[model samples]
Target: MGNMDISLKEMMAIDGAVGAAVVDYNSGMALGVVGGSKDLDLQVAAAGNTEVVRAKMRTMESLGIKDGIEDILITLTNQYHLIRPVSGRGGKGLFLYLALDRNRANLALARHNLRGTEEKLEI
Candidate 1:
């Protein structure tokens, strides 16, 4: 378990991590961000991903799927984007966004690590 800053740093330590952020899906804002390059804007990405999360939630509702989302994965030619909702009490509407280099990252391990980090993250 760790504070927000620590958690963000820990995420950046993951293999092939390019950037990471804690986002508010409701507001499409990033509460905290780390490890983004000039070409990769974490804040903008976070806001855009908020829409993705909302759309998925809406689809799930329409389908009557009660299962909670573990994470949403978007694979690109050069990168991978992961969106994981926070499950802790008082953590709803928040999610962790992680971007990684596809060529260098192990997707399974990165997901595992991010989930573990999400469990430990403190608002």
Candidate 2:
């Protein structure tokens, strides 16, 4: 069972990771954050992404899609934003957000690592 600190630390270790946060989507609050610079504000990212998650969930429900979201990826000109909702009982309504430098990050590897981290996370 991994704690938030460990989970966040692991996230930051990912190649090209610039910032990471564990957020409570229900309240749009960040439980923990790490690795943000002057240009990257994790708190703002957390709050803004909460709406993204909610909107997607709503859309899925409205469309009668029963599948759960594994993750959401947003690509920018220079970066990649990844949002992964926690699936464990202890982490309900929580998510892990990661921002990566597109040039340095291997998207497939990052996604795989995030999934492993989530599986071991204990909120």
Candidate 3:
């Protein structure tokens, strides 16, 4: 079982990682954050992304889709934002948000690493 600090550190070690946060989507709160640059406020970004997760969940519900979300990817010209909802053990209403530099990141490997981190994570 990984604690928040350790988990955040591990996430930051990922290739091209610029920032990472563990947020409570239910409350739009960031429980833990790490590695944000001076230009980016990870806490604020985490809160804003909470809305994105909520909106997608609501849309999925309305569409009557029973499948779970694997991850939400937002690609920009120079970066990638990865949002992964946590749903194991006691996890619910929480997610891991990771920001990566597009030039240095391997999308597939990052996703795989994030999944591994999520599985070992413990609130």
Q: Which is the leading candidate under TM-score? A: 2
Predicted candidate 1 versus true structure: per-residue lDDT over 1-123, tens digit per residue? 349899899899999999999999999999999988998999899999999999999999999999999999999999999999999986789999999999999999999999999998777
Provide the TM-score for each candidate, comma-separated. Answer: 0.96, 0.97, 0.96
Compute the lDDT for candidate 3.
0.93
Candidate 2 runs further than 4 Å off = none
lDDT score for residue 94 of model 3 = 90
Instruction: Please provide, for model 3 over 1-123, each residue's C-alpha lDDT reduced to its tens digit, 9 standing for 90 to 100.
Output: 348888899899999999999999999999999989887799899999999999999999999999999999999999999999997966788999999999999999999999988988888
Better model by lDDT: candidate 2 vs candidate 3: 2
Q: Please tell me which predicted candidate would have the highest lDDT against the true structure.
A: 2
User: Each model's C-alpha lDDT?
Assistant: 0.95, 0.96, 0.93
**Model 2 — which ten-residue stretch has the worst lDDT?**
1-10
- Assess the local accuracy of residue 60 in candidate 3 as a C-alpha lDDT between 0 and 100: 99
Candidate 2 residues 24-111, lDDT tens each? 9999999999999899899999999999999999999999999989999999999999999999999999999999999999999999
Model 2: lDDT equals 0.96
